[model samples]
Target: TKSQKIRAELLFKQFEDIKHVYYYSLELGKIFSTNYDKDVARAKLALWYNKIEEYGYDTFTTVANSIENHYERILNFFVNRSTNAAAEAFNAKIKAFRASFRGVVDMRFFLFRLAKVYA
Candidate 1:
């Protein structure tokens, strides 16, 4: 395992793009994985944006632009580190339940059954 890691590091050093991309990914993971304050998170994200631009990779440029576009919404994560995961999961469950029943026929009954089971 140690040898494998050394070989991987050598390869990363040999490839400029790979090294940049790998470090960028690692930095982004560190940014989100830590429970940093909002200001600290924002500062890190700003640094990340600049770093991505400096990398000058087309794909990363596009991703950076997207982040810029949704900047506020993304930053809101630092407030509570919450996401719409629960809502999305519930929606998926509803879809699966409907599919299992071969689709909804009576809207009223469907609402009642959904409320009884999931409410």
Candidate 2:
């Protein structure tokens, strides 16, 4: 909870002039695996394919294509780290460390504290 207000205030700054927009990207194979209606889901998957082509792509498409092209090992990666949780967790930890040093009321004491805590 150290410096939570400062963190929240900083986070709130990002939304100061925000605009709302909606964009959808889909993972059709996963949807179909547990889909309620087989026929409708299949049709929807086709529609999503068409929409993706219309919307085009960015770098992720290349990476996704690589995954499919490799197919053997990378599909296993997609299964395990389904989301980017590991990377996000590291970033969150670093942010917390930065937050704890916010006041830095005493440089000598702060350095000592940081060294003791992180050493």
Candidate 3:
């Protein structure tokens, strides 16, 4: 939508800081989307970290600190872009079942039902 792009450009012009944040987010998306080799992606991620640090934005800085803390596990994505989406979905399903039950009165029955559904 060229019109939407034009409108966004106009709006972005009015807010320089917002524009920077927006573009930086878009750049981060690009870094993930690009099918770069692991080495290149790692380097890009490091560079992105440094760039965000330079901005000194508290929100991005907090995210940077978290990323730094779990950097190794995070970087494992470069291996094959693997994710815990399936595990998350399973957890969600379990939560939904729990919510539906309100509370499990019979522990054995609940375990059997959970095994039937999930195992």
- Clash count per candidate: 0, 0, 0
Candidate number achieving the greatest lDDT relative to the actual structure: 1
Report the lDDT tens digits of candidate 3 across residue range 1-119. Answer: 99999998998999888788888788888987887777898798899999999998887888789978988787778789888889999999988987899988998998899999889
Q: For residues 22-102, what per-residue lDDT tens digits would candidate 1 score against the true structure? A: 789889889999999889999999999999988789988998999899988988999999999999999999998889899
RMSD of each: 2.1, 14.5, 1.9
How does model 2 score by TM-score?
A: 0.28
- In model 1, residue pairs whose N, Cα or C atoms come closer than 3 Å (at least 3 residues apart or on different chains), thus clashing, are none
The true-versus-predicted C-alpha distance at residue 9 of model 3, in Å, is 1.6
Clashing pairs in 3: none
Task: lDDT for model 1, please.
Answer: 0.91
Model 2 residue pairs with clashes: none
State TM-scores per candidate. 0.82, 0.28, 0.85
State the RMSD for candidate 2: 14.5
Residue range with the least summed lDDT across 10 consecutive positions in model 2: 17-26
Scored by TM-score, the top model is: 3
Cα lDDT of all candidates, in order? 0.91, 0.52, 0.87
- Ten consecutive residues with minimal summed lDDT in candidate 3? 70-79
Ranking by lDDT: 1, 3, 2
Query: Candidate 3 at residue 22, lDDT?
Result: 86
